[model samples]
Target: MASSNQQVPYGYEPPQSNVRGTLIYYDDFNDITDAALEQAAIVAEQMRFAKLVLYPLHEQTVRRISNEQVAPFYKREQRLQEWKLDSGRKSILVEGWDGKRKKYTPIEAAIRTCMDHYSSPYFLLMTPEMANRFASFATFEEWITKISLVLTRQPDHLHPRMETFRSRWRVAGEQRDKNGKQSEL
Candidate 1:
């Protein structure tokens, strides 16, 4: 029994208690293998049946192996120079080197090998039924409310790595703030 004047949270519809229609979801294409595409398809199907839409997003296919793989090609002494030039600064670099040589695990090596040879495909899947259901919403705000609700309920639809990366980034930011406060004192 909330009042009309009360503000509603983003992606949440005030009048409607349940979410409906096809909701758009975005997922990154890290490695476009059969397994990866199959997973995307399965998630898409699950979402579609649940009355949600998924739109996987990929910026571009990484054409080369990550920097860690290529680091061995360059001389150890020249690593920093190469990094400053172009070798290690590429977007394909996932986990960067820690300034010390470290052994890569078998799984890591396998993933790098695959990335070196395969081209990642961008994924975007949506059903044709979306337009009809979307029209029922009165305003853009209402549509956003529905979309937000869908995303909130379906965490599995998101890219797992991205969430971990975001959490780490948040922790790092908090640590930086704490350090700055200590330095000022």
Candidate 2:
């Protein structure tokens, strides 16, 4: 008789079949080896994927614009009106200021207002390289403070996907801390 510790290749059904001709496992399903589990985890990590979806901040009704439709307008440095899918109509673009062609002025004012309202420091991913460099920080809060300081001086460097990147990092750091505590316990 084979010992319980003997390695069993996956899909190695015993030389028996059910009445329906389906191979049935005789061993306990929960007896997966640690190596097998680790291999599965590695494969999953290799295939892992993520996507960022952006929604309007306060608008209840909004439209989805395809990349192709928006690309030309963006390339030409022209303002495009947001489309409303529910009503099948285009919404008027609201200009924050009159006759000003500055790019960062509006964004800076908005960021300052938000910072004043929150009265707390926050983080921005800024760039892919910056996000990757954040791993060297001692803690997530420290990283946030550093990024907030940079934003206070130069808010124009803020990345378009900063919120998504921040969320991913925050969740990952929380999970790491939880695992550490569990291991200690």
Best by lDDT: 1
lDDT for model 2, on a 0 to 1 scale?
Answer: 0.26
List ranges where model 1 is wrong by over 4 Å. 1-20, 23-25, 50-144, 148-185
Give lDDT tens digits, candidate 1, residues 15-57: 7423223322222222224443334334434433222222222
Local accuracy of candidate 2 as per-residue lDDT tens digits, 1-75: 875776789989778522111110111112234443233223222323121111111111101211122122121
- What is the Cα-based lDDT of residue 72 in candidate 2? 24
Per-prediction tally of clashes: 2, 0
Name the weakest run of 10 consecutive residues (lDDT summed) in model 1. 56-65
- TM-score result, candidate 2: 0.21
